[model samples]
Target: MQTRRRFKQTKTLSDRLADEAARCRAEARTLTPGRRREMLLRQARQDETAMQIEAWLRSPGLRAPT
Candidate 1:
């Protein structure tokens, strides 16, 4: 019997937030106008979170290694 190992790459927080935002937007497209509003809001929040993560990454505090 041979064992196979699967290699998985870890996703960064920004990447995950971006992916979630995309998924929320895609789902919103399939929803009714009334329901879509909530999804759109969720997508916006995800996008905002991603932007915050990116901003944090660029901050001077994070630039230097501890």
Candidate 2:
């Protein structure tokens, strides 16, 4: 069987997500208003929202749902 290549991630998920959102925003700023720019901005929003949800999940006061 062929094994998949595995690599270790150096940055935490939150950090990685933040970096991605920032990169997307920067790229979007450089593009003219259009579908591609809109898509990039949407991705950036998603990354930011994910980061928020992750933080909320990790909060100390949260409990598992029934």
Question: Where is model 1 more than 4 Å wrong at Cα?
Answer: 1-9, 61-66
Per-residue C-alpha lDDT of model 2 across residues 1-66, encoded as one tens digit per residue = 999999999999999999999999999999999999999999999999999999999999999999
Clashing pairs in 1: none
TM-score (all chains, Cα) for each model: 0.54, 0.89
Tell how far residue 20 is off in model 2, in angstroms.
Answer: 0.5
TM for candidate 1 is 0.54
**lDDT for every model?**
0.77, 0.98
Q: What shift in Å separates residue 61 of candidate 2 from its native position after superposition?
A: 0.8
- TM-score, predicted candidate 2 vs. hidden true structure: 0.89
Candidate number of the best TM-score: 2
Off-target runs (Cα >4 Å) in candidate 2 are: none
Worst 10 residues of 1 by lDDT: 35-44
